[model samples]
Target: MDVRTAQKLVMENKHAKGFNVTDVPLEVCLLQGEIAEFFTAWRTSEGDAAEELADVALYVLGLAGILNIDLAEQMEQKISKNAARVYERGANGVMYKTTPEQTSAEH
Candidate 1:
């Protein structure tokens, strides 16, 4: 199923369970928890990685649905933007954005 269909299913399940996640901060925390679970599953190589990843996606989609955001469109736009990005690692070991000119000069 598509993302919209999956999102709809998640909404239906949430409604059936009376799970009202109105608090944005709580929702964000839950999403972060799911992300941790996904990484744990990846590191252990024991649990179902696909299920954990799906859980992360569910939380993300649910949050977007609650906010009335077009997640798919946003994802596409972000992908397009990232595709043209040039990044550099700082002394602090964080990746920072670099201009196209800087990227060309590095080559």
Candidate 2:
């Protein structure tokens, strides 16, 4: 399904459960909690990891729907920006953005 369709379904599901995403802070916290669950599922080799990931996406899409944000568009824009980014992966396995000069210097 499309992002908008998924958002609509999530909103409906939330309302069905008598939950509202009006509280942005609470929604954010809930989203963070879902992300933690996803990681835990991954770490433990849970077969339900995909479901946990879906929960995260549902919460995120629901929150975006509540806030009237076009998350898909924003995601596309972010992906485009990432595509043009010059970054280096550190020993800690973190990706850090680098300036053109820094990139050239590294080479």
Candidate 3:
């Protein structure tokens, strides 16, 4: 039900099939940084934004290839994690809050 349980299940399932590319957060964050850098360059335009974006996108794609993760799926997960609060139950949902790391682990 929780993130820890979900991660445990993933690890358990992976035990039987011979898992690969275990760096989930690292790979995801690396791509995210690249994405940020790309947008930053695009905004500044003091450098080659197009080339920077292309290279970062390609590296991100390569990382995705190694991890066998779909960018769309990952993006959806990221959005979902960021879009709503899991702790909200009553009418006072706005009171609930979490950190960036906690949000990241949920995905």
lDDT of 1 by residue, 1-107 (tens): 88778777887887789876577788899999999999999999979889999999999988987887878788887888788888999999999989653355675
* Candidate with maximal lDDT: 2
TM-score of each: 0.74, 0.76, 0.39
**TM-score, candidate number 3:** 0.39
lDDT of 1: 0.85
Tell me the deviation in Å of residue 50 in model 3: 1.3
Return the TM-score for candidate 2, rounded to 2 decimals: 0.76
Report residue 105 deviation for candidate 1 (angstroms). 27
Q: Residue by residue across 2-90, what tens digits does model 2's lDDT show?
A: 88788888889888998976899999999999999999999999758899999999989999988989888998977876787899999
Scored by CA lDDT, what does every candidate get? Answer: 0.85, 0.87, 0.62
Regions of model 3 farther than 4 Å from truth: 1-21, 69-107
Of the two candidates 2 and 3, the one with more favorable TM-score, higher being better, is 2
Residue 55, candidate 3: C-alpha displacement in angstroms: 2.5
